[model samples]
Target chain A: MVDSVIQTKDLTKKYGEFVAVDGLNLEVQAGEVFGLLGPNGAGKTTTILMILGLTEPTAGSVRVLGLDPARQPLSVKSRVGYLPDQVGFYDELTARENLTYIARLNGIPDSQIDRRVDEALARVGLEKVAYKRAGTFSRGMRQRLGLADVLVKQPQLIIMDEPTSGLDPEASHEFLEMILDLKKEGITILLSSHLLYQVQAVCDRVGLFSQGKMVLEGTVENLAQRVLGGAYRVLVDVESVQPEIAQALEKIPGVAHVQVTDTKKYQVEAAHDIRPEAAQAVISAGGRLLGLGVQAQSLDDIYTAYFQGGSI
Target chain B: MTEAMAQKPAMPDERAVAALREREGSPWTGIWSVILKEMADHLSSTRIFILEVLILLAALGTVYVASQNIQQTTAEDQFLYLRLFTTAQQPLPAFVGLLAFFIPLVAIALVFDAINGEFSRRTMSRILAQPIYRDALLMGKFLAALFTLALVCTAIWLLIFGLGILRLGVAPGGEEVGRGLLFLVATIFYGGIWLALGLVFSVVFRQSATAALASIAVWLFFTVFWGMIAGVAAQTLSPIRIGLPDEFLAQANMELALSRFSPNTLYAETMVALLRPEIRSLGILLPTQLEGAILGAPLPLSQSLLLVWPQMTGLVAASILLFALGYVLFQRQEIRA
Candidate 1:
């Protein structure tokens, strides 16, 4: 069993009468890439702020690395690195100077600051423009600089809110690779993103939050299976006619429906794995099978199923 | 067999280990870092450097021209060395007066936006996320601005001293030098009061431009317009009839008391005390039979200082009070950015 790195029990944050985060209980395990998947106004940012001790939680406790963020924020912050959804930087300083300043604030030794700064810049592929003022940097470069600021400290747990919210596809792919690289170094990363495909690609586990509560928490595969129901799709290509193939496949146990598109193509819906028996029946019926594949549910399907139904 | 036997090492519980390694220390480290950065930026800016050099040269040139004019016309060197080194006697009291006014304005301009600009740039939230506390941030900023002002004042002071030695061909007496140092301290305190006032406005106002505008407005009101308005108001509202001695006395006291309220008046009065070392009372003295008899006797320096102690304390206390209020506002403010 993996030990939990971050645990929030009955955590709630209220702004006036509006409950921004309502009794959120979350457990992020050590060395896992956890994604907080949510739509706008889902309180994901608010939750991250509470965990960082930026915003006070109205009720309950948040423990990061077994330290209460509210009571011992310095300890939690010293160990964790955070990249806010909207990146803000000092425009007067160059990228190198900015990273050096952040490194100093993180308590790195003066002798080691330059080396760490160079390493961080290199990690983000920003060494070429490191000496240029950040004000002149493009949005993508600024985002990369913000990532370097986090990476310079070599923080154990990195919390990024909407890490790829505004990135182009190529930048997003590069960022995902960096995140995976960090994960490989045994760093725990918790990121919030609206892009389900991006989350599906990198996250080891995910928590789907909606209406200020965690609606679902599991691995991507588990969430897809649980929320999308047991409907399995099987696509096949036949060598010859399939009008009788559909009728014969429909008669198989646990097979719900069968539809033939062309003389060689057919889609079968089943409650279980009936592919073997269906293939055998199709062959016996003189329909030679050309190809066979199982269709798994996508993240979009799981997202739509949970949100549209208002429950997981 | 090799694949079956291969195993990963135990992951060192990062969060737990980091918690164990946490140390206790002052939270002001990050704030000092910001203050250092602000000072370095201001000091390194080309615009500020040019302004400083221009102001310094202008002041020295004015003093030099005034001394030369006095020597050419009057053939008396009494006001020569004094005017060169100090603002004791000059054709342009307004120039010296503007020096007192503009130095504070410039210092305040350098720091008024120190905190608010960070917020406007949205960097305050990022910095505040570090281990530093709010008080540390404010105090660090105050110190940085104070240090910068001190540097400017010191530079100007040394330049004047150098000019005096070169032009006069004699070093100043200990008393004269002592008075000059006191003037420098008073100038710093005066400038600091404005710096604190500017920071207070910065905290109270959301926009940096608004804070700066408010500071300049207050400076203009006190330095340029307030005294004129007070004089006019006194003339219009005077209940004392023109002919009576008692009326004159009452009006004189009222004017003297009211003058102390403005920082400009307070500073001027303090400079007068330091320069003259006589005129024990700021209030006007009634003409008497003994007035003509004791005109030659100068008051002792100790008595002179004691006479002005209340006014000096009031001005310094006002500065301190403004600074304390600024500190309190900064500490209580939420770091929203």
Candidate 2:
């Protein structure tokens, strides 16, 4: 059983009458990449801020590494790194200088600061441009510098808000690779993003948030199964298949529907495995079966299923 | 196994280890980081550097012109460079008096948007996110600005002193140097009051432009126009009058009192008290002998400081009070930019 590194009990945040986060309950296991998936204005950033103790919640409690964030924010913050959506830095300083300054702020020993800054810059693939002032850096380079800033402290948990929101495909890929490398070092991460593919690629588990509430939470596989109702698709090819072949496949156990696509192919859907029976039926019906395959569910399908025509 | 377990000591938990690491780190390191970073940015900004240099040149030029004009008119050459060394023996107050009136404006210009400009750049949230407390952040910025102001002002004061020694062909007396040192402290406090006021306005106003405008407005009202209006109002408001000229003098005193409401005025008045040993009031006093008979033969340096103590304390305290207010506001603001 994995232990919880970050846990919140009924965490809420309100801006006057508007509830930004309401009764948010979350448990992220140690060493796991947890994704907070939500649309715009869904309170993901607010939730992350509260967990980092940067913002006071309206009510409820938050614990990181089993310590109350509100009562011991420095303790929690010391072990957790955060990147706001909009990264702000001193434009007059070079990337290396920025990282070195942040390292000093994090209280790294003066003797070790240079090594840590170099290591962080290397990890973010920014060592080549480390001496360039951040004001002259591109958007992608700035994002990398931000990642380096967080990495310099080597926190136990890293929380990122829309880390790849503005990056192009190549930049996003590079950023994801960096995150994956961090994961290999046994650092737990809490990432909030609207990109489903990125979350599906990286997150060990994800929570779907909507309008200040966690509507669903589970592993990617589990969410896909739960939202898509455990449905499986089987595609078969046949030679000289009859309309009766389609009816025969449906009559078999567990199969839901069979649609004939062409003279020698049919699309089969079932709530469970009906491949064995469907194969037997096709052969017994004097149709020569050529191929059979199951269709894997995609995160896009699950995302649409949860968000379509549903209220949080 | 059970006996071995009982004999072995318990190790610290992960949470305890993390807490130890945090406690081992000094929080003030973050405050120093912010100060260093802000000072670096301020020094590198071309606009502020150019402004500082221009203001310094203007101050030097004004003192030079005033000295030369004094010498040309007096025909004795006694007043040449005398305005720079001391206000003594000169019919008019020294150029330092003009500096006292003008330096606060330059200082205020430098710092009026110090805090609000950071907010405009959206850098406050990032800086605040570090481990530093809000009070440390505000205090660090204030101190850094004050340090910069002091450095610039000191350089200008030295330049003026050097020019005076060159022109007069005589070294200044120890008392003159003592008075000059006292003037420097008074000038810093004067600039400090304006700096603090600017920071308070910076905190109160969200926009840098608004903060700058508000600071300039306060500067003008106190330095240039508020005393005139207050004089007129005091004349109309007062029920009794001694005589025409005396009433005007009374009105002027009332205006001076009212102008003290501005830190700029308080600074100028305090500096006058410290720099000019002969100056008795904002108004001209009777010749020193008659004045000495009324008070004493000669007032001690300590007594003169005591006379201006309220004004000095008021300016210093107001600066501190404004800073405290800014600190509280900064602490209460959400770190979200």
Candidate 3:
């Protein structure tokens, strides 16, 4: 039986009448990247805070590494590193110093700290600017340093809240790669973010959250399929527009619509792979097919559908 | 990532063993870590450097003028070594007066931003997320700031003593040295009250600038204005009848007790009682009460401590009260940016 690194049973958090996280039950295995997808005020951060034992749950229980986070937060915190949203460091301190401070907080002995600090900084690609004050670093670099802060402890579990929220595209890519590397090293990761593509890139499983409720949870592939037979899209290049083809494509069973992109292109969405039939339909409709290819349903589509209070 | 997730979990009882190990480690997980980090930050910061230098120069300048003027022997020829604290030149106040005025400034500066600045800079949540309990972080900040204040005050005291020895050529008697050390401890405790007050403001106010202003405003009220206000309040609360010593006595004692509510007045009283041991009483005494008192006779160090014991305890109680307020508020605070 594989024990989950983090298990929350009907976790709920309420501030006065406002429920921040409502009856959230979640489990993450010992070594996987789990993304929590949510919009602002979706209680993602509140749930994360409860898991880290930073805040107490109004109801239910949390077990991190099989230890009750509320009763034994030190044990849980010592092993489960957290990277808060918009994570910050001691701006006046150098990256090395900041890491050193966190390493000490983890009770890493002074003799081992220097080596660990160097390793963490290097791992985050901050070795070149290790001595620079964190205040001088760009927002992207600071986010990288937040990663280093989490890694410096050599934790068994790492939780990052919107870890790449402020990073540029290239930096976000590197950050996601770092998350993958940490997962490869057997660190359980739970990251919460609204950036669908970034979360899809690295997260093994994801939970869609809305207004403090876990609306859906599954592997991205599983969700894509389960939501709407994983709605497949077809990009069709035609020699000319068929005035009737768009309506005919829509008339096909399970096809939502066929959008015309010029006189020569049409995009189709269907509940299943319909590219071949789409091409045949185009031919029968007297349109010369230049190209046709099937596309998978993206996380964005499922996410949008979920937020719209409907299934894809 | 999928392959890693597919890997088997750890041995069934590994978590139990880890829990046992965590329980066995020392509970004081991060006191030294917080203290060292904060201490380095305090000592290296330019703001602290400027405050220390400012107080040092102002104190040195005043002590220098006083030492230059108070050279003649008095009829009593008593507490010559003690004159370092009490003697004032034509323009400059005594060392104690300068300290009574300046130490709060230094202390308030050190602590007004201690907690809120961490929140504003977004380090509070990260630091508290460590294995250490909330108690350690709050304690570490208090101790570090207290340690810094002690260091600054001790340096100033030593410099003044050194200057006294060089200029007056009179080595302090052992008793006088003991009294001076007690005065130094008292001064730090006094600074501690302001430090705790500043920390309380920091905890209550999210903005560092607001905390700083609130702390300084409170200190100013107590240091410069509270005594007068307390006097007026006491008079309004306890009106006196003409030619009735008991009524006047009631009014005077009321005023004195009300003023002692301010740490500045308590500290000034303690400094005066300890540094000027020849002073025998703090309260307004009836003529009959002064009959047994030998004029200008220096009290023993033990007697001096006895006289100011309540003041010392008051300073300590105020510090602990302020710190408790700050600590409770800090613990209740949600560590979010």
Candidate 4:
């Protein structure tokens, strides 16, 4: 068995009958970039709070590095780095000064703080404005500064909640590359995000969370096999708006769901390659099939299905 | 905002280094971090700068006026040094009275957003997640506020002392300096009570404005309306008829005790005792109770301190109690941004 760096058993958090997290069980190996994939109000933040020992679980246990965070949170916290959603820095402090404060908070000695802060700033590519106060930073720069803060801690595990949220695609791409680079360093990364495209690129394993419950958990490929069941999306762009074509395709045995994107375009979800059947049905239903392609069901479908009270 | 967003393109920072926390530092690593960070923040904040400037100007103006009055009245006066604290010009209070008012503003400025501002700025969770205990964080904030209070008060005290020496051409006597230092300490303690109140309100309310308003409201109630309320309460509690001196005395004594509950009253009484050494007791002593007492003799420094010892203790106790309450509430709260 691999060494699990974090484990939780039946972790439940209830705020006066509003259960934020319900009977959640989880395990992460020492160097896995795990993602808690969920929408808002799905208990992603609440679960992370419990794991961080900042919030007490109503009824459960959480262990990080084989130590109970509830009893010895200081040890767990000291060993784990956390970059919260919309991380904040002292606005008046320079980038270097902010990292220096974090270094000191992480118990890095005075002698090493300067060298480490410079390295962190250069790593995050903020060394140019290292002396600039955080108040002058843009949102993207602030986010990177938050990353610098986490790096200054040099913890074994780093947890980020919605790291790419509110970021432009370019910055989010760069951020993911950084996470992957961190993974290459063998540091465990547990991040939460609603964007499947973002998490799928870097996460080794994912826990699909919804309404305070762990609806599914596995490697992306494993989850794809388990929930999608070899399902593929057949995109058909027809020449004309065809309502009966989608209904006829839905009547096909393997086709499970069909979405009419527009009068000339629609998508079909099926358990197998339904492209030929979809094209035949569209043609027979008085529509010209201009183009058809067999596509695997993307992570978007999985989230929609899982959130709409269906596991698949 | 756009300038920040339009920052120049640069090569990304390196990422493949600095692994694993060494975990060798002491548990108290974050105290100095929080203290220094917040101390710098407090000092540089516009709110503090404005209030600090206002307080210094007020202190200097009042001291200058009081010194001019002292210079005019008595050139060979005994206890001329102590008069710097108590002497007032026409239409102006003494320097110590000025402190009793300004210290609250300084303390409130130092700490009105101690807890909730962190939550609003989204820094509380990150700070608390550090290796240090919550105790260190709370203690650090309080210690920093106290340090700021001590700094401001000591600077003002020195300025007053210097001004007095230049005006009177003599240094403060030993007893007067001792009493002045004690007064400064008591003033700090008095400021601590308001700082703690601000901290408690900050913890209780999430919005910074509400916390600030709440602290100010409490300060106003205690410093201004509390005496009137206590007097009314005493009268309501014990009514006196004509020629019933005993009942009147009981009413006055009850009023004194009730007013003592206010930190301002405690602080003011303590200052009066320290600056005016002829005062013996707070209670109204009858002729029989004052047997063999010297009417106008100055009290020793030790006797003056002893006279106001309970008031000092009350201020310190109130500050501690409020701080402890804030600490406990902060501990129990879920650290969410």
- The C-alpha stretches of model 3 lying farther than 4 A from their native spots are A243-264, A284-286, A309-312, B1-27, B74-78
Best by DockQ: 3
TM-score each candidate.
0.82, 0.84, 0.93, 0.89
Model 3 lDDT tens row, B5-107: 6554555357646754664445466898888888888889898999998889877887777666655662335566667678887677777888888888888
Tens-place lDDT per residue, model 1, A31-125, is 99999998989999899988887777888888889877866777777788888776789887899999887887777889999999999999999
Note the B-chain TM-score for every model. Answer: 0.80, 0.76, 0.90, 0.89
Clashing pairs in model 2, backbone N/Cα/C closer than 3 A: none
Kindly give the stretch of ten consecutive residues in candidate 2 chain A with the minimal lDDT sum: A68-77
State residue B220's C-alpha deviation in candidate 2, in Å.
Answer: 3.1
What residue pairs are clashing in model 3?
none
Candidate 4 lDDT, tens digit per residue, A1-312? Answer: 348988998999999989999999999998899999988999999999889878889987787888767666777887898999999887878888878877887778899999888888888899899999898998888989989888887889999999999999989998999999899999999999999988888998999988899989987766765676646778899887757887888898877677878455787777778887888898889988799987765677667656664755
Candidate No. with top TM-score: 3
Every candidate's lDDT: 0.77, 0.76, 0.85, 0.85
Give a tens-digit lDDT track for model 4, residues B1-337: 8776655333121211121132233545579888987888787788888988888888888878878778865556767877877877778887777788888988987898898988998988788777787777888999899998898789888988998889878777887888889989999999999999999898899999999999999989988899999999999998886758889899999999999999999999999898899999876789997899999788888998999999999999999999999999988887889
Model 2 lDDT tens row, A48-164: 988887788898888888876665766677678887786777777889998888787777899999999999898888899989888898888888888888888889999988899
Q: Any idea what lDDT model 1 has?
A: 0.77
